[model samples]
Target chain A: MALPSVSRRLRHPFPFAILAIALSLSTGVASAKLRVVASTPDVADMARQIGGDRVSVVTIANPRQDPHKVPVRPSFATRLHRADALVVQGLGLEHAFIPALIEGARNGNILPGAPGYIDASLYVKPLQVPSSQNRSQGELHPLGNPHFNLDPVQGKRMARAIAEGLERVDPSGADDYREGLERFTTLLDEKIEEWARLAEPLRGVKVVSYHNDLIYLANRYGLLQVGTIEIKPGIQPTPGHLENLLRLMKRENVKIIIREISYDPGVARSLAERTGARVVPLAVMAGGLGPEGYVDSIQANLEALVGAVAESGSP
Target chain B: MSFRFHVGRESRRGGAALALILAAGSPLPVGAADSDATTLHEQLEATQREAERTRDEVAELKRHVADLEAAARSADATPTTTARIAPVNADNPAVSFVVDTALDVSTQSSWQSIGYPDGWNFTLKNGELFISAPIDPFLRGYASINGTSDEGFDVEEAAIITTSLPWGLTLKGGRFFADVGRLPHWHDEALPFVDRPPSIDRMIGGESGSEGLEASWLMPIDLFIEVTGGLYDAVGSENLETLNDNGFFGRRSFQELNFLGRIHGYVDLSDTFNAELGGSWTGIPRDEERSLWALDVTLRHQPGTQSSYQGLDLGAEWMWNSQRFTERDDGGAIMSRIRRRRQGGYAYVEAFFARRFSVGARFDYSESPEGAADRARTASAFVTWKPSEFQRVRFQFDNSWGDQQTNQRFTIQWTAFIGSHSHGFAQR
Candidate 1:
């Protein structure tokens, strides 16, 4: 019995101990840099700004694709599986896909309500919070609109939150994250002032948009939104709705029409021709127009707004 | 307590002395000593009354203090009940319903020719209701019930999946589709075509699933590698009759259970192209020991800088089955053991040239399971129009050739989903 017991003990000697040692060594290397998964390209850019050289980032939604219709791919799950932290726009913007990916990834550190999870919307006040949770409101976000990333001031707050999230997961790099956040904030503040000055002529300018995605951008530049080309949030425009929108546009004397690049430009073009308003196609997210980063993308949008207003004459 | 009593005693003595002085100073007194004595007696009585009053007030204060102590105890108990009760989660699980119906027009005149009594006719192909929710912090549950025009209803899938297992390990229990092949794992509504490929349907059965427990691990590497293993009571309803005849050959021991294993790999070649390859094996023991092996490859191309709808999907799958049967003949003598091996597979290519329109073609080939029948071959083409993410309509045509039989069929399918759902019908 003693010999058999000795043989059995030898057969499984130190298996768990070996596993523990291997895990510790692997985690030691992995803990040196944070891995972040962002729900959209803009959030990915913000995380990059905050994490700098201490982080690696992957984005789920591509810039050219509509964020509302992002496909749920196994690749997204794989990326999330290795993520140490997660940053999302919240307000139900990524409701369709992000939950499934998180569940599939099976990463507890990034689950909702965890310390490594960052809901960027918590940092900035939301707009268009619906008074009623009714389907008749037409695809309304129950919490609020989740397009605050387009505003540089709100983007700064979102970057700060992401930095805090990174620091929570990788505390040794807390000082590095804080420095990165400060540098990003200063650069963004200066840019915001410059963009505001360039957008001065667009103040009080009446405009129509293809969808409600431009609300944050319009608010930042002091544009008065008149109407939308769509009858509802995701619904196609009916003839009656189009006629009513045309009448309202004429009455309001809308000077410009802003359309996202992801949407079909045919409707925006026809409306502009009918109303004599200049049509401006804007890249709603970073990397949509080109490989531009966050700040440059926002500047490009402002430049487009200024050029559109100049073409439309004085408001 | 003693301090209040001392003040009460002092006040009573002072009142008695003052009353004595007041009576002595009265003008109507007959005898100064007798008046003073009466006045002292009345003052003493009044002092006794004041002491009784003060005692009663003290008792009342003690009763109030007891009541307050009782109230504080009751307040302490209130939160225990309230805290034990928690508010329900407002973010309820997403529920979705999908209805897939088709109008079929086939050259075959009778349902028998199509294998099913209800086939070869316009029918409700499938109506599925799906419910999924996170059970807790560590697990999520999903259940789907399907109804068909021919078969009334069945629980298609009811599974609980671990969401927080370490090392990228996921454990799933309850009934689910067997991870045998690419097509079998996909729900009918999630299929790219109107009907399953002829080879898969003829050889391994279409949409075969079983009650099982599965554990899958995603390897910790740069490339996506998943290894999965499962144990099931039976492979599926299609093979249940063939495997178990309710005799000695029926499932009686653990050895009769089905065992399945699969290894899948995914690689991203470029921003626009990715490849997925998988190999699967399953074994079941009974009077006839049946084993199946399948290999699948899928290549997808979608430019990151373009719309998601514009893409190309090319896939191919090959499956082989072997069965050995031992049985006695009608003459009460042992018959020669029968051994059969059949092979089947399909290859398909689909392209989305426009945002909403997609076209695809498939070629299917299979060896007949029956000894007398010849090989079967089929060619199919389909076009799908998706107006939105939740709705799709497809038109398909199939041409088939087999021993002494030629068949042609046309199908128009309409599928729609309603309510909140994470996985759409055509995500695969």
Candidate 2:
């Protein structure tokens, strides 16, 4: 009888230890709202619109910095440690820093394959999938382009994914999350249609960008992408490469040079001065334009493109 | 059963079969044999025409079915959903290899003796293989093996780190770099300079690594403060000279074990500026009375938009050492035992004006730790360029002047890396 009692006591700690671990990994359980962490400002904005009052959201990467090279700050890990759900842009966009932060967070709830880990890129069709790649070929995204957020139509899919992600982390608020998602989708749909009509002038306008961050936006409208200022995707432009680009621009009559606000405008400005083209400083992510929401960011970029194209086409 | 396809062919076939059966089975009346035969012949001809039309319709139906099946197959081949981007291979330990080679020219005749190569020498400075992985839910593991042309491969570090402890506690066990100061904790390739500063080289022994167990606590306060304590069987590099009889404090008993304590604090001064300050104490508890104390500070500035392109770094560290040394009389008699107090330090500034380039200058001053009258002062400057994330090239020049010796040296180093190597949060 004594042996049996001792064995029972020994068995109790194992279950208790597991319970403790479970409690540590689960976040915002004792609070009224769920905690969500997004990899970029665009995803954060979308999560806010979809989660509404039922959830609180935090962004990891700064919108003013290049998305590819966001520094992994220690405070970001602390935020992730207390988050209930993590929504990532995925498609290798946050490859450099997000993985390190997640591992440092030590929060098993948001690890890959877990219910609280949400990859919004899963809902959108990927573009520019390389047939072959190597470092020598420049910074090519092996999983295709990850800038789907720039496409206004892809916003609907990203919102839906975030809503479902919130519901998964906080099932008690499933009804609220679904209603919030519906409201966001309705407004975004109307805005997308209106923006498309306004972008008619950019349909046939030849355009170039500082980097390849504009493919999704170009495809959304009918803009003809003729060239890029950079020699390769992430490679800086050399003089020889610039010479070729200028010739191509002149021959193609490219009227607009689109540059992300995060990049230095030196090269793009030089190119524009030589080719008699207008330079358009566009925001690549939400909040890149100072607290602009996701819809407003896209509209701002679209208007910049349209205004430049119209100005150049005037007799 | 009913089908969506036309049944015209089947209907014609049924009529023809019925007419043929009637013609074959029925006997003609004697009187109307000719007329009946003519009627039967006409009906037979019509039945044959209907059967032909039915055959044609069936052929067309077969072709349509083939086309529909083909269309479905093609549709099936097109992927409806984009494949998830494969996450970086996190399930397996990240394995990486690095090779460092250098061309050296110096005033010293023997490169190996001075820790710098002689005139116009090519050397394979170091080769390293690094691996890291999450061992389980509770611990993550990391290892680094290094080799040189002169010395064969050695296990530089192999440690297990705690992952999911209840509090803000981290525990590390096995061989690792002692957190005595900022310089001692950094790997050679990660250092901003070509070589360790002379002050650190003389005081802490070139590479101050040890086999030990360390535990750190992240203080529960707004300021980023972490305190670490470690216990080691011995400390210092085996190849270095000086300090506790050839740059190492070996423990013969449990009481003689080496111990270290460090407190590090970091603060974000502004959106583009941050600073870190740390204090460290390390000593061996034995009759020899060996101890070292150091304080370090670092400040960095990087604008949000041009973080990768431009930055400024200012770092400095000061150290104090006190050790017991026995003096010998000229008559080969023990004169006395005295504890010597010596001080040494280094300061450096680096500026990154472009995305791929940075230049830095450092000054070092240190007194002999052996209670001798010799002291050294050195000045050094270096430029580094990174062609890509996986490769680096650097050129460094140093001028040293001391009571015992004066020397000048120049070195060019190139390093290449492959595979998924990462240094965790400390890389930035």
Candidate 3:
């Protein structure tokens, strides 16, 4: 079968011309909106708060999906290709997929350690930093737990980082970003106090979580974490571990269990039946419960915790 | 004064009196001598105490110096132990090894034709060692070596890809699996079934990879579309004798080199469902000029609200080949041309009902390569259990019918990976 030569194939100009024209038209009009690609929806929401209308935000991980297992799709690379800045939750939270996406995107400005790259975790104090880097500890992040966005205080810090990153990318819009950040922070401050007051009754409450993701929230509200359903970070609980956890919960009089919406609730429910604990499925990020903004999701999480503790009785 | 007088009386009183008499030339006053002797004795006592204190200070300083020396030695030893605990090799590339083993049981007396023996044969099919690293700011390199019981060892894929190419273009050079169809690009261990679909195996000769340079362009569009083209010396494995150095083609010309082209497009119907369509073409020149064309489609549905493992995947691939052979007379002159055309396809549907368990079925059909009147057909069902991301076990049952022969085979395959191997999306 004699196929046409490469020169003859190249001579056909109609499709090539159409493709070139389409690409030019699509990219020709340079909008002033800063193209911001965030690692997760919560970070995207924070970027939106800081950037307002001055930025266009694209989130890599869906709100309802597990952040640890975000799929690396070609669309992510496409979005990152045109981005002026990239915001990440960063202390290895996006380790599995973000690096590959950045590599695929081939955008030098948004690579790690570059000016347009922002690590939101940098502004906030990390939690659960292990003393030893041991594989037996399961999938532990070497830097620390990367889920500090659960704490509203850290959310404000993340907003500030996003603002700084936007300023670096689009210096002309720096004033707008700063003003937006101030307004968001003021609102966050009020919510934090209100959330603290609402959570006063549950202070020092003994609780068990399905994973170690709730440490920041627990620390914020003074909830004493007695145990976890999973044996380690990212490791499923063995029967022996579950048995020990059940005994510890019973002994400690733990009556509240917090679990992320992404995790299966069957184990939590089984433990609840055994120990009379109320299982509360909370959103790990901004979108787990629904399509919520950052502040709304944190508020929803606070409400879920308070209600579960109240129903389960005081510590 | 009285103590001095007492000392002089007890010890060398005679000598002291003699010296006093010689100096004074007369007996001096006892009170003056006693007072002078007392002052001298007190000065001597103070000097002895000072010397003793200085000796004690020197001993303490020596002990501290010894402690510091010991601490310095300990500090020197600490890193070696710490390194054993957490070894650091900044230049080492991310490495992973995957072992794929299978147990096969067949009703036929010998399955050796396909590299498996009948009646509960345990085969160490392949152990693949993969290494990948960023070579520099502009390029990244990756290599995979597969060691098998039969083939010993072979460089399955070794390629360097350009990272910072302009216009969303990526260039890859070296040996790699050509992106001809969905299944060919995937390693056998990453495949959904225990083995390659029968039709793909028959049509493309198992895995269609070659040593070549491939350039891919990601079209700057709202949707995902990638166009790729490459040129290779040969289209298949080392065993593809028809395309390799066999006397059938005599001296091959540069024009006879194999060429491959493919275009893949992806679209998301919704947050939960997405579909991909791809087409590929390969031209191979031999005594009989041959060209193969393939089309593949895949649909996946995984709700964002649900676990990733709980999803549905459906896929299909169609392949057609055209071969033209020029017949020669006794004088080595071409007499007539014979043309043969063959087509084959396979379709599969898989559903994951739980996080760890999945069930799938595939149907394969192909026209006989020998131009037999009857077509070859096979049906297979497989159940897979993935305990974690690192390990998977699958049990598959196959029944094939062709050439008026029916064969039944059962296989249990286990595949596990260790270390860092980021292949982006999970195996479909």
lDDT of 3 by residue, A164-211 (tens): 888988999989999999999999999999999988877899989887
lDDT of 3 at A124: 88
Q: Could you give me the TM-score of model 2 versus the true structure?
A: 0.79
Estimate, for each residue in A139-227, the C-alpha lDDT of model 2 and write its tens digit: 88899999889898988988888888888888998898899899999999899989989998888778889889777888889888888
lDDT of 1 by residue, B1-428 (tens): 78487657858686767767676766755686686778677877777776777778778888999999999999887775535645486657778989899997878543232352224677789989999888998888888888989878978889888878999998989877777778877888888899877677666666656777999887665455667889887665556434545665445566567777777767678766888788787776554566787889999887633355578999999988887766788986868789888888999999986656899999988876663255777789999987555678999988777663677778999998776544421134
Provide the overall lDDT of each model, using Cα atoms, as 2-decimal numbers. Answer: 0.77, 0.77, 0.79
lDDT accuracy of residue B303 in candidate 1: 62
* Ten residues in sequence with the least summed lDDT for candidate 3 chain A: A8-17
What stretches of model 2 exceed 4 Å from their correct place?
A1-33, B1-92, B107-114, B239-251, B325-338
Arranged by DockQ, best first: 3, 2, 1
Ranking by lDDT: 3, 2, 1
Steric overlap count per candidate: 0, 1, 0
Candidate 3: residue A219 lDDT (0-100)? 85
Candidate 2 colliding pairs:
B9-B54
On DockQ, the leading prediction is: 3
TM-score (0 to 1) of chain B for each candidate:
0.74, 0.74, 0.74
- Estimate, for each residue in B228-338, the C-alpha lDDT of model 2 and write its tens digit: 788886566552222235444442665456677777766678777878777777766554456787888888886657444688889999889887777779997878888
